[model samples]
Target: MEIRALVFDVFGTVVDWRSGVAREVRRQLPGVDAEAFADAWRGRYVPSMDRVRRGEQPWTSLDDLHRASLDELLAEFGVPGVPADARAELVLAWHRLTPWPDSVAGLTRLKERYVIASLSNGNVALLVDMAKHGGLPWDTVLSAELFGHYKPDPEVYDGAARLLGLPPERVLMVAAHTSDLAAARARGLRTAYVHRPAEHGPAATPPPGADPEADVSVASLTELATRLSA
Candidate 1:
């Protein structure tokens, strides 16, 4: 099938969640290990969503999940001095994430040739806010909240293809995480890996190389644009 659309994993792929969250954490709680705090918050992301995915809990938005996790972490990190209003604002940090250096220009290039959209676990409102804040240029915003399932859940990937009126093979799932790509591939969607070495934090190690299971991989979105253009 000819590829027609590219759906991206927003958090670590298009946006730098670690630094973004850490920056907000530092602003809210000075004198803390912001990077480690960011990592710890993110570490709970999948597990938090898994509860909903497994039907152990009702469908919940990522925004709600982030708040729940944030509240718990605040207490754990002994930062209860943060006011409720401030904590609410801090939880919105996910909405204010910064895009990778090449993200905007690269997505613009790819958008010219493909229908680009977000395929993320973040809710639609969250994606919209990030796109506006980071100047992300997406044709549409698709989220697990829209389909009632998170990534690694077939429904999310399949739902994106369905919404675009394209077969699975006609849509490429782009992400920094190999596991996300693998899940998309398992559902017959093509996969592209974009390496994001510092997504976890400044000290995080880079992906060794292009993932063996990825149908295609590149160091940056700009490089992916070049490869697709060729």
Candidate 2:
């Protein structure tokens, strides 16, 4: 099927989320071990999501999960003296995630030819804030909050298709993560991989053999846009 709209995964896909988070954390705490704190905080992400998925806790957005994780990570890292108000300040960090350098320009190229939206696990509010902060230029934002499900869940993928008034095959899901593309591919959405190798850090490694499975793989959004625009 021909691809039309390009839907993106925000965190770690369009943006180097870990790097951005680490930068923010570092900026907020001068001369601190920012990278260590970034890794520590991100490492808590999945288990927290699992808690929500398993019904151990009520539905929570990514922002709330970040806050919960922050409290644990700060305590573990022995970061001293963050007031309650300061805690609220840190929780909003996700709102200002920085975009990958190629992101805005690449999305602009693709947008000239195709509709672009974010099909991410982030809630609409968070995605909106990030878009505004980063000048992401999305035609619309499609988050898991709309379907109350997260990525790798079929509903979120299908929900985006339904919301866009398109069939599964006509929409393309672009991301740096293979598992994300696998989920989209399983549901008939075309899959594209735009590499964000530094996503996990300098030593980050790509998942073995997953790139070939993508309809196309490129090093950056600009490259993806070039191919799609061709």
Task: Say which candidate scores most in lDDT.
Answer: 1
lDDT of 1 at 193: 93
* Candidate 1 lDDT score at position 79: 80
For residues 1-230, could you state the per-residue lDDT of candidate 1 as single tens digits? 78999999999899989889989988988988999899999999999998998899999999899999988998898886778887887789999999999999999999999999999999999999999999999999999988888889999999999999999999999999999998999999999998888776656676756888988989999999999992
lDDT of 2 by residue, 16-46 (tens): 6776777777767766687888887778877
Count backbone overlaps in model 2. 0
RMSD of each: 1.1, 1.7
Q: Backbone clashes per model, in order?
A: 0, 0
User: In angstroms, how far off is 53's CA in candidate 2?
Assistant: 2.1
lDDT score, residue 167, model 2? 98
